[model samples]
Target: MNLDHLRVQIDSLDSEIVRLLNERINVVLEIGEEKKKAGAEVYVPSRERAVFDKIRSLNSGPLPDEAAHAIYREIMSAALALETEMKIAYLGPEATFTHQAARNKFGVSVDYIATSTIGEVFDCVQNRSADYGVVPVENSTEGAVTHTFDQFATTPLKICAEAYLPISLTLLSDQPSNEVNLIFSKQEVFGQCRSWLTANMPNVKLSPVESTTKAVKLALETPGAAAIASVMASDMYDVDVLAENIQDMQGNTTRFLIIGQEYSAPTGCDKTSIVFGVKHKVGALYDALSVFKTDNINMTKIESRPSRNKAWEYYFFVDIDGHVEQPEVKRALDELQEHCTLMTILGSYPKAEI
Candidate 1:
């Protein structure tokens, strides 16, 4: 076809797309009204999942699934803003990995609050100051984030969703790599990029700051300085990415949890997290865990933290492969509760999108 003919066809398609999008928005606004009247959450993960699944099934495309998903993401994001002024709290100074993950899940249309600590993220959701909060729970390479685990012990917030952010730790600096003399990053980030620092900038002074965003800020202020941070930070902080993927290990991804008042209704494919303290005695831990095996449940993760008020007492945090509302999962929890001093079902949430 001639270029002018194709251009005319494209313009006509765009007109139809705009009209259809508006129609979709009007329907979404009606949904928002009903949700508000019923006091239900407007952003339903399972419904969104169904939409994406159906879209993928119907797709016979020159366009890829990821591209289609991105398009719908922004469409839903706009609908969400029209539906409600949802606020997301995250470990921040902005542009940090937690903030990035929050944006990934909640999208950019909603407002975000930057809390100084992971605890504050919990408090914001618990106190109803924020609709949801996001915090890093674990890293693939560095292991469990203890702070997030500890917060579950006291906080009533449930894990509404989970996000897995692949860490591509970059070196952000105003100065070139050769001119850089100092490096700053969060304590955890330093460990992730330890080998890279050892091999490349052995003589440079290493400093640990509160967050990667803070590191970028410091790097921007101080000449001859570099920061280990997300590539997103480089743009937000106006620093150059001196190097990309600097972590010694490959495939470093941090798992973050979305904290909110109530656990989401069961998505057929879901994961449940729980924390419990076993009565300190021989085989107590084993007996508690054995319930999963007996019920034919698959446990995905387990980590422990000191239970604080008592000496040598600990809380065992576990992630299992089914929703708490599921019959098999409920029965397993009932059997598991028999051996614990205290137990709490933290939350059941949709698994992170692959």
Candidate 2:
């Protein structure tokens, strides 16, 4: 085909694409109205998962699966904005990893509210100040985020969805590498990049701050100071990237939870989380766990935290491999409850694919 002929075809295809997108969004708006009348949630995680799965299956493509997913994410994000004034609260001052995770899941079209602490994120959702909240639950390198766990112990919020963000820490500052005398970042971030710092800037003093974004701000303002943060922070704060991929582990990822009023419905492949306090007796913990084995439910993770109300008493948080609505999972949890002083089903959410 001649160049002019091909150019005409490309322009025609682009026009068709725009028309189809608008048509799809019109249908989405009709569905949103029906949902509002029925008092149904606007953001349904199971439906979201099914849509993405279908998109991947249907794609034959010039575009990769990730690229397609990204495009659809923004499309759905725009639909969501039109359907409702959606607000996402995250643990941040912006450009933090939690903020990045929130944006990754919701895309750029929805509104975001940055709260300083995880507790505030929970509170925002609990009080209806935000439609949903994102909080980091655990990191592959740093273990559990205790603040998030502690909030789950008392809050009525449910985990509606989850996301995994691969963390790539960078050393950001305006100062030249040789002139830098101090480094600042969150304690967890410092831990993640400890080896890199020791090997590259051993003489520089390290200061732990409230958050990496906060550290970036301080770095921008303070003389002879650099901050270990995400590359996004470097751009947002206008600091030069001194070093990249500074985290000790190449596959370092943080798992974040989406908290809302209700848990997600079954998606076949899902995860259920619960917290319980065992009776203070021998074999009590073992008896509680044995219920899962009896019902043949797979438990993925377990972490214990001090109950705080009583000395030496603790509450165990567990993640199991099936939705709470599943027969086997329901039976196992029912039996497990018999061995606990207190038991609460935290939430059942679709497992993050990434």
Candidate 3:
């Protein structure tokens, strides 16, 4: 076809695309009204998962799966905004990793609140000031975020969904690499990039700060200072990227949790988290864990934190392979509860795609 003919066809296709998008949104609005009358949640994780899965399966084109997912994410995000004034609270000063994860999951169409601490993120959701909250739960290289786990020990919020964001630390600065004499970042971030810092900037002083986003702000103000943070922060703060992918481990990822008033329904492939305290006796912990083995349930992770209420007492947080509503999982937890001083089901959420 001639160039002018192709151009005309492209314009025609664009017009049709916009028309269909509006039609789809009109139906979404009708569904939203029905949901409101029935008191159903505005955001349903199971429905979101099914939509994404269907998008991937139906995609047969030059466009990549990630690209397709990103497009639909914004579409759903817009629908959610129209349905309600969705607000997401995340740990931040802005451009923080948690903030990025929240945006990645919810898209750019919703409102975002940046809080200084993980606890505040939880409080926002608990008080109904925000529709949902996002907080980092663990890093592949650094292990569990104790603060998040501790919050789960007391909060009434449930883990409705989860997201995995790859951690890519960079050296951001306005000064030349050689002129930089000090670096700033979160303590955990410093540890993640320890080897690179030792080899490249051994003489530079490392300053641990409240967050990477805050560190970027400090770097921008302080002469000869650099910050180890995400590339997104560099762009947001207009700082130069002195180094890229500086984290010690390749493919390092942080797992984040979405907290809400209720957990998601089963999606077959799911994970359930719970916290419990066992009796103070030898083999007590073993006996409690043995219930999973008896029921042939797979335990993915376990971590213990000191129960601040009592001296030397601890609570064990566990992640199991199946949903809490599964028959075997229910039976196992019932038996496991018999061996515990206290037990709480944190939530059952769909396993995040790594």
Candidate 4:
């Protein structure tokens, strides 16, 4: 074909694509109306997951799944905004890891509110000031965020979805690494980079801050100072990154949860989290866990925390590899309940992609 003919063909394809997109939007509007009539949530996490999964299955593309999903995320975000205004709450003054994870799940087009503390994030959702909340649950290097686990013990909120953010910490500074005398970041970030900091800046001071973004701001204003933070933060703060991937582990990841009023239905592959307290007796916890073994269910994680209301008492949290509504899971919980002082199904959500 001639150059002009090929350009004409491309224009024609673009026109059709635009028309199809409009048609899709109209249909989505209709569905949104129907959902309103039935009083259903406009942002259904299970439905959203199914759409992304279908996109992956249907794509035979030059674009990768991650890239395609990112595009679709914005499209969905726009539709969701039109359907109903969504306000997502996250831990921050802005530019925190939780803020980035909130964007990862909700997309850049949606509204966001940065809360001073994780408790305030939950309070925003609980008070109906925000439609949903996002908070960090666990880090690959540092284990669970105890505050999050503890919050679940009292909060009525449930996890609807999860986002796994691969964390790459960068060394940002106003001065060169050799001459830098002060370092700042969240305690967790410093712990993750302990070895590197010990070996490279042995005599430099390490200070824990409220957030990594705060550390960046401190580094910017203070002389002979540096901050270990996300590369995105470096760009946002206009600080030079002295080094990339400075974390001690190559694949450090943080799991963030999307918490709301209700849990999502099963999406075939699911995970359920629950917290319970075993009765104070010998073999009590052991017999309690055996319920899963008898039911042939896979338990992914188990954690314990002191029940602050009762001295020396503890609560146990567990994550298992199926929805709570599944027959085996249901049966296991039924059996397990007999040995526990209390049991609560935290939430059942789609398993995050590897």
Candidate 5:
């Protein structure tokens, strides 16, 4: 065909596409209205899955399957955005790792509130100040964040989602100097970079700081001193990264949780978090765990914390496959509750793929 004819054909196709998209959007608005009438959430994962399935099954076009799904995913996401906005709370003075996780999950368009502490983040969601809370649950190198687990022990909020982000540590310095006298960093940060620090700056004294932000500030004031922090810290402090990804383990990662008041139904791939305490008797703990075995529920993580209210007593925090609303999960929970002195289903959330 001539270039003029090809241009005309392209314009015609564009118009057809635009019309179809408008029709789809109008239908989405009607669906949103129906959901509002029934008091259902705008984010219906099952409905989304069905839409994707139907599209994939019916697709026989020039556009590839992956391309079609990508377009549809964004389309559905836009439809949900039109229905409602999500508010995410995170531990921050801003630009912290928790902020990164929050933004990763909800995107920059979603409202974000940075609370002073992890506990405060939990309160923000519990009080409905925010729709969801994002906080670090565990670090690959340092293990669980006790403060997070403790907050979970007291709060009614549950883990509605989980995510992992590979964390890279860096050394930020104002000017190049070999006279490194002090290294400022969080204790965990220092630990993660121990090998690198030992090899290169063994003479430098380590000073444990409150947070990565604090370390950056302190290092700025102390000449010949460096702050061990994320590369983001250098950007925030107006300093240069002297070294990057200094953690001893190259693959070091942090696991974060999304806490909210609502419980998610099973997404086929789901993770349920729970906290429970055993009765003060032999075999009580065994009985509590056996519920999972009997019900064929797969346990992913189990960590213990000292009960703050009761000396010599411990609470077990567990993460497992399946939502609490699922029959198999419910049965296991019932059995666990019967055998335990105290119990709570923290939250059932879509399992983290990253």
Candidate 6:
């Protein structure tokens, strides 16, 4: 065929594709409405996974399977958004790392609220002010976010999903001045950029702030001050990016948790989080953990927290291989709970796919 003829045919095919997608989306919207009535969750990672898996299996792609999955994820996201108005709460004054993580998970279509504190984020979810809350849980360089751990122990909300976002720090300041007298960032953030500070700006005073956004705001207001924060913060606060990706380590990352009222079903690949307290006896903790080993399950993470009401008592937080409802997981939990004075299943959530 001639070039003009081919171009016309391609354009016609593109138009047809759009029309078909729109029709499919309309049907998906009706399914979402039915789900709402049946109390089914909108964002089902497992169902989405199944869709991508089927596509990959059938795919003989010049476009590639990953590309196909990417297109489907957005389509699903848009369809879910059409079902209900989702409100997401994140730690913020806006432009915070938590805010970015929330946006990454929910997309820009949902309503996002930036609360001043992590507790506020949790409260938003618990009180039904928000559908979900996103908060930083751990970092690759620094350890756990203590407040997040504390919330898990106290809050009724469950961990619905999790994400690990690479934490990139940027040094931002106003104007073109290089005379940086002070560095502002959160304490843990400072630790991640420790080597960079030691090697480049050792003499500058480091100021620990409540958050990255606050640090960036201070830098914008104060002369000779530079804020070490995510690249998004610099853009939000209108500060010049003095340095990009200034984290000491190349693979610096932070794990964020999604707190919500709903529980997630097993995504085939799932992580179940539980908390239990055992009587302090010889090999008590060892015996409790052995349930997983007996069931041939993997323990992803374990954390110890002091019981608030009782002195000398401790609560153990665990992330295991399978969903809570799975046969093996159910047996393990039942056995483990018998070994403990108190036990709680915090959540059985779909493991972070992205």
Against the reference, the lDDT scores of all candidates come to: 0.90, 0.94, 0.95, 0.91, 0.82, 0.85
| Model 2 stretches astray by more than 4 angstroms | none
Off by over 4 Å in 5: 1-35, 42-82, 177-179
Candidate 2, after superposition: displacement of residue 74 in Å?
Answer: 0.5
Mind giving the per-residue lDDT tens digits that candidate 6 earns over 1-354?
Answer: 999999999999999999998999999888888887998877765676577678889888698886886677677667767778878899997888888888777766778888988899989988999888899988888977878888888877888888878888999998563588998899998999888888888889999999999998888888789899888987777788988888989898889988887678776788888888898799999998898999999998988888897998888888898998899999999999889988888888777744
Q: Order the candidates by lDDT, highest first — what do you get?
A: 3, 2, 4, 1, 6, 5
Worst 10 residues of 1 by lDDT: 42-51
Local accuracy of candidate 2 as per-residue lDDT tens digits, 28-147: 999999999999999999999999999999999989999999999999999999999999999998999999999999999999999998999999999999999999999999999999
lDDT for 134 in candidate 2 is 97
Q: Estimate, for each residue in 1-354, the C-alpha lDDT of model 5 and write its tens digit.
A: 999999999999999998998888889889889988998766554455567678989999988986887677667656656667767789885656777766665655557898888889988888888878889989999898999999989987767677788888888888684866898988988888788888988889999976777788888999888888777777876898887888999989999987777766677778888999998998989888998999999999999999998899999999988887789998999988998889998888777645
Tens digits of lDDT, candidate 4, 188-306: 99999888888888999999999999999999999999999998898798999898888999889999988999999999899999999988889999999999999999999999999
lDDT of 2: 0.94
The segments of candidate 1 whose C-alpha lies over 4 angstroms from its true place after superposition are none
Please give the clash total of every predicted structure, in order.
0, 0, 0, 0, 0, 0
Task: For each candidate, give its TM-score against the true structure.
Answer: 0.97, 0.99, 0.98, 0.96, 0.82, 0.92
Candidate 2 residue pairs in backbone clash:
none
lDDT (tens digit, per residue) of candidate 1 on 183-245: 999989999988989999999999899989888888888978899999889888677888999
